[model samples]
Target: MDPYAWSWNPEGLVVLLLAAGYVAALRRYPTPWWRPACFGVAMVLLLAVSVSPLHMLAMQYLLTVHLFQNVVLAEWAPLLVVLGLPPALAAAIARPSAMRLLTHPALALPVWLANYMIWHLPWVYDTALEHPSSLLHLEHALYFLTGLALWWSVVQDAPHELRAGTRAAVVFGAFVLVSPIGLVMALIPRAIYGFYVDAPKRLWGLSALQDQQLAGVLMALEQAVVFFAILAFWFARFFAEEDRREEIDRSPEAA
Candidate 1:
């Protein structure tokens, strides 16, 4: 199959169904323009990665493409999806006891970290590729789901929105925890994923190991940029909150 040709899968249908459901839900709740905007972009990203030529390249030709796809699924798409939720909807969802417990930073952070690391293990990664019928879908599903779980506390104004200081800590901690995987993938002497190493004559005249290294470097850099950007936002919010509290404390009414 031509690596650049567009391919449609059940995944595209899934994205559309999600969009449809979201649209239906919006009729009942007043939503800000930005909420739908975030959701629309996320669905577009999900659909593009599922149906565009990029999906083909990831499935067949390049680990770099596949890693890029994973990053979108696990990081970019999920963050936007969470951001897209209306605050009323988010509060409703968070009201569930189970969701409240699961989204707690104590649990969400570790689950996301483990999910991120476990899927990248060479044997696991290679097996998912080899058996795309079953495991590949599972892999993608978990990435998206856990990503929702991961970002829920950070983005949602829900049952327990994290304090700005705590949110900054969680984002920074995740950045630190996940950095090692990318570093290992980049610095390792060889391509660890056998399926990629064994793929047909590599495109762009690149060997498997070189492609793997590039994927690793890109992944690390992407994480650093995304995480630090969020960290800065949260830190700013933290400082602002601190200033507000200090101002109230110094007010004559309090005195």
Candidate 2:
């Protein structure tokens, strides 16, 4: 089989089922058009990265592509999924005790960070990639789940609304903690994951070390853009809240 040729992944079934469930939910609980649109876009993105040639490229050919796929799974898709959840639905989901505990900022942040850090460790990363029984699928699953949990505290206003300042802090802290991983990968002198080095297909004539560096750079850049945008949004909200409070204080009724 041609390494770069388009390949289909059975994993697309997971995305399809999720889309179907969301459609059913929409029928029962009508929402603004944008909600479903956000969800549809996210599902399509998930399908594209998982079911399309991107999946095959990441699995068999390039570390750079794999890193890109990981970012989409762990960040973009989860964020969009959270954005798509209507307030009523989010509140209902959060009513479950287990979900409340899982999405709590205290637990969610650390777990998400750990999930990300542990998977990227050289031995662990290689081991997952080396076997078809490949802990890889598990890794991807955890990434998506933890990513969802991580965003819950920031995005979902129904279960518990964090103060705007607090949300900004959360985003900033997460960026601070996670940024180093990619920076280290980019700066490291050698390719850390042995699996990529031994893989049969080398695309674009990139050496293993070069590919590793490229992946790290891409990961770092993407994280910076996404995290900073979120931070800015929360900061704007924080300032707006403060302005509203000041206006209330200045009102004749307050005096």
Best TM-score among the predictions, by candidate number: 1
User: Once superposed on the true structure, which residue ranges of model 1 sit more than 4 Å away at CA?
Assistant: 252-255
How far residue 77's Cα lies from its native spot in candidate 1, in Å, is 0.3
Question: lDDT for model 2, on a 0 to 1 scale?
Answer: 0.87
- Candidate 2 regions exceeding 4 Å error are 252-255
Which 10-residue window in model 2 sums to the lowest lDDT? 1-10
User: Per-residue lDDT of 1-255 in model 1, one digit per residue for the tens?
Assistant: 687899888899999999998998899877989999999999999988899998988988899999999988999999999999998988887888999888888899899889989999999999999987799889999889888888897878686867899989989999999999888989999989999888876898889999999999999999999999999999999999999998988897766
Alpha carbon deviation, residue 87, candidate 2 (Å)? 0.9
Q: What is the lDDT of candidate 1?
A: 0.90
- In order, what lDDT does every prediction score? 0.90, 0.87
Model 1 lDDT, residue 19, Cα:
99
Root-mean-square deviation of every model: 1.2, 1.5
